[model samples]
Target chain A: MGLKRNVGLMEALRYQGKGPMLTYILHRIGGLSIVIFVGLHILAGYLANHAWGANLGIFINSIYENWLFQVFIFFFALFHAINGLRIVILDLWPKLIEYQREAIWLEWFVFLPIYGIALFVIVRSGLGG
Target chain B: MKTKQRPAPLGGFNFDYIMWLFTRLSALAMYLIVIVALTGALLMSARQNMSIADLMRWAFMPNPNHVASTNIPDIEVWKTIFWQVMAILMLFFAGAHGLHGLLNVVEDYISSRRIRMSLRALVLVIWVAISLIGITVIVTS
Candidate 1:
C-alpha cells in the first residue's frame, strides 16, 4: 500500500490503459456466460434422471473436467466476484464515485486474487483427487 | 479547471475518473491472469500426444506438474482456493440477482410486514444452504 506509485506517462498510461475497458466489458459478459451456462447446468441437475441420466448431465460433467472449462469458470469467477463487489460498493458508498480509481485497484488487488485462489481450490478438490 | 456546473469535490479526485481507472486496471489484471492463463493452458497442451480433452485431466488437476496422484497439499490448497472463490462469485451472482429479484417479487405482491420478513428469511436460508453444499463439493473432492 506504500510502494509509491510514481506513475510516469508510460506507466500511467499502462495503469490507465486501453486493456481494462475490455476487462470490465468482458466481466459483464462473463456474468452472462455463467447465467447462460448455469441454466443448462441447473437443468442438467434436475434432468439427471432423464436421457438415462445422460444428456445434460453428461455435458455438465464433461465440462468441469475440461481445462478450458476450468479457465472459463476462473474468468467468470474473477469478474463475477469483482463485479458483484462493485455492486456492493455502489450500494454502500454511492457518494464515493470520485475514488473509483482507488476502488478499482483495491478490487483487482483484493478481489481477483481472492477469486483465483478460491476457484483453484474449488475446481481442484471438487473435480477430485 | 473550473466551470459553473462543477459540483462539490469530495477528495480532489473525481468519482468518474476513479471509476475509469478501476475499469482500466481491473480489465488489465483480468487479461493477464485469466486470459493469459487460458491461452497458456491451451498452447501447452497442443503438443501433447493425446487429444485436448485428455490433456485437461492433468492441467486442471491439483498439481499440473505431476503426472500421478498429486500431493495432498495440492488438493488441499487448490481446492480450498477454488471453492472459496467460486462461492464468493456464486454468492454475488446468485445472491445479488436472485435475492434482489425475489425481493422485488415480494415487494410487488407480498406486502405484509411479517410475511415479507419471513419470505426474505426463507430466501436467505435457501441461498445459504446451497452455498454450503457448494463448499462441501469444493472441499471434499
Candidate 2:
C-alpha cells in the first residue's frame, strides 16, 4: 500500500505534537547542525595547515569564532547531547518510557543553565567585555 | 514456566539495528573523548593562557596544532602520539556517527530505494574523504 502524502510542510509544522514532537524535531535539527559544523571544522583545520589555503582557512575559522555562530552551534551541541542522553537512558530502561515527558523536562533543566552561561561568555567575548 | 523468545527476523543483524547501536555507542564515546581532552587541557592550565577558540579546538580534537596560535609557552607536551591517536579517534567516531545520522534524516524524506542507496554511497564517500583529510592533518601536524 502506498503512503498518503496529503500533508504539506506548512500543515506538518502546524501540527502541534507538543513536547515529544518538539524534542524530536529539535534532535534531528541538532544532529544535522552538528554534522555540518564538524564537517566545516575539519575542512577548516585541513585548510589552515597548508600555506596555500591558509587564508581561506583563517576566513572560515573567523566565521566559527563569531559569537553569533558560536551561540547557535553551542546551543545545538548542548541540547543534542542532553537529549541524546535522555534517549539512551530511556532506551536502556524501558520502564522510564512512561515518564518520557518528565525526562524531557529534566533535560531542559539540565541544559539551560549550562547554555545560559556559555551564551553569556560568548556575548561578553564578542563585545570585548 | 519460562517462555522462549523467538529469534528475531534476519537474526537481528539488520543494518538499521546495527546503525542504531552504533549511533548510541558512538555518542557516548565522543562524550568520553571530549571529557578527557577537557581534563587534559585543565591540567595544562589552558584557562590561564589559551583563547576560547583554541581551547575549544583542542577540546574537540586534542590535536596540538589546533592550539599552535595560543600563548602557551611549551607545546612540546601536547605534541605526543597519544593526542594524534585521540584526534583520529574523534574524527572517525564523529564522522561516522554524524554521517549516519544524516542518512537517517534523508531516509525519512526520500522513499525511493534507488535514491536512498545513491545517497548512502555519497555519504560514504564524504565520510572517507573527511577521515582521510583529518588523519593526514593530525599525523603530519
Best by DockQ: 2
lDDT of 2 by residue, B1-141 (tens): 222232333547788888888988888898899999988987887989897767877888898877888989899878888888888899889999999999988766765667878998999999999899889888888
lDDT of 1 by residue, B100-120 (tens): 444445643453567878997
Q: Which residue pairs of candidate 2 clash?
A: none
What is the C-alpha lDDT profile of model 1 across A1-129, one tens digit per residue?
A: 222323345654466444346556566567656545544554454444456766767677567657657667666755665765664565456797677767666767876676677566656666684
In angstroms, give how far residue B92 of model 1 lies from its true place.
Answer: 12
Highest TM-score model number: 2
For lDDT, the strongest prediction is 2
Instruction: Assess each model's interface with DockQ, reporting 2 decimals per model.
Output: 0.05, 0.33
lDDT of 1 at B89: 50
lDDT of model 1 at position A70: 66
Interface RMSD of each: 14.7, 13.4
Q: Tens digit of lDDT per residue, candidate 2, span A4-112?
A: 4446678788999999998999899999999988888778888988899999988988998788898999999889989998988898689999999899899999999
Kindly report which residue stretches of model 1 are placed more than 4 angstroms away from their true locations once superposed. Answer: A1-20, A51-53, A115-129, B1-141
